[model samples]
Target: MKPLVILLAAAAAFGADPPAREKLPTSRADLENGEKLYQANCGLCHGTKGDGGRGAVLAGRKLSRAADDAALVKVIEEGVRGTEMPGAWQLSARESRQVAAFVRSLSRVSSKPVPGDPSRGAELYARNHCSACHTIRGLGGSAGPDLSDTGLRRNPAFLRTSLTDPEAELPRSYQLVSIRSNSGSTITGARLSEDSFSIQVGDSSGKVHSFWKHEISELKKERGKSAMPSYKQLSSADLDDLVAYLSSLKEAS
Candidate 1:
């Protein structure tokens, strides 16, 4: 009886099942580290934070909720080929986890509305030259896709990556074309309209070209690639603000 009493006392002192083993952070620390890593490695083009610069802004957009941590890890490891997002095999498993955390944080923060600044976003959109390529509500150029109802088609996470790495996940239709002419000039554009005889392409300058497909000596098409620039130079906060603005561009009411 004395021994039994001592055993129970010792168990109680150990503090009830050892405090549940301190549940591991769902990559929270990794997320913080990822933010730092992004600044160091991906900031130049993707922006310091995640705002558009030479690249796309990636804070508020939702890409694919179906992609879990493992899927994201694979992408980080393998990298998206045929795009500016070079393979990041340099990162270890832990480091990749950290980046995923940072990416997830973008949406959580940008989910709220910007107080007293509904119009600020519209102004920013124009000032940033987003309209130069992307079309919104029948405005802007035809060089990029129409973002008239982007809020409905894309999620915040997806939008963030799209900004940070435009070529990362490209739409099926917007394939990249690299045409080498007889004069040794190379023309790269997004395939706007194509056929066996003639093809229409939209270049980065917002100019469209109609070329005879048969006349093209060497024509290469990189599927699942985009001609859009990467916005890896903006700050994380700016990226968040930009994403917030874009996400709010929903159809009227």
Candidate 2:
């Protein structure tokens, strides 16, 4: 099918009139309920108006254009593992749909980058020591996945989350590690740097530790979350600037 037809079909499925470009909710009550749900559950991280804070900004995001209601509902219910956002399966299906509606409402306006400043982002990357764990351009640590082509693979929303709450979104290969010592001590963290003889782990505290394979008597590997932390201290402008920087690092066409 043509891309235009697919878009129209998606719009129609969401009760949106293509020519009007207006989303028709089942009822006003649903919209209101969605707003309230967003406030109570998503406000702190995403901000009251979804401008982002401890969480990635949702306002003016283009996610709705890429994802439909069903996808949105899944994200809300399952939550993005390896980040600060937790699963919200407790919400009823109706409520989940309502929240999805609210999130979609935030995307009414598009938020494209104004030609990102890769140089500025490069400085930010170094200052933040992102290279300590993640690799970029074949230079950096091996703890996280190579980000050389992240611009193509991930959207801006996902990139923002990568900065703020990495653990919320878990990648496929990076498994979570739970280590129980012979003394009955336990530790849980994501693998940062690992090899055949030794493994390095980063805990929730942002502290990284290395251990030889023989040292861990009871090592359990589970689905690991992203080891990134929330940037609660960063101003909104700074967050946007950093996002701009990271989003610009796309592979050459």
Give lDDT tens digits, candidate 1, residues 82-189: 545665778876776677667656645554343323356677667778877788877787777787756544556667788898877776667789887666778898
Best by lDDT: 2
Candidate 2 segments exceeding 4 Å error: 1-26, 64-66, 81-84, 110-117, 123-132, 137-139, 143-210, 213-244, 247-253
Roughly what TM-score does model 2 have, to 2 decimal places? 0.50
| TM-score, every prediction | 0.51, 0.50
Error of 1 at 37 (Å): 38
Q: Give the per-residue Cα lDDT of candidate 1 at 36.
A: 86
Model 1 Cα displacement at 12 (Å)?
A: 81
**What local lDDT does model 1 show for residue 244?**
68
Q: Deviation in angstroms for 85 in model 2?
A: 3.6
> Could you give candidate 2's per-residue lDDT for residues 1-253 as a string of tens digits?
6999999888788785443332336578998999999899988667677755556557675553236666677778888776566778778878877888888888775555634466777777778787776767877766566777565445566677766776676664566788876667777777766788888776655467788877878888875444555675766666676777776665532
Among all windows of ten consecutive residues in candidate 2, which has the lowest summed lDDT?
A: 16-25
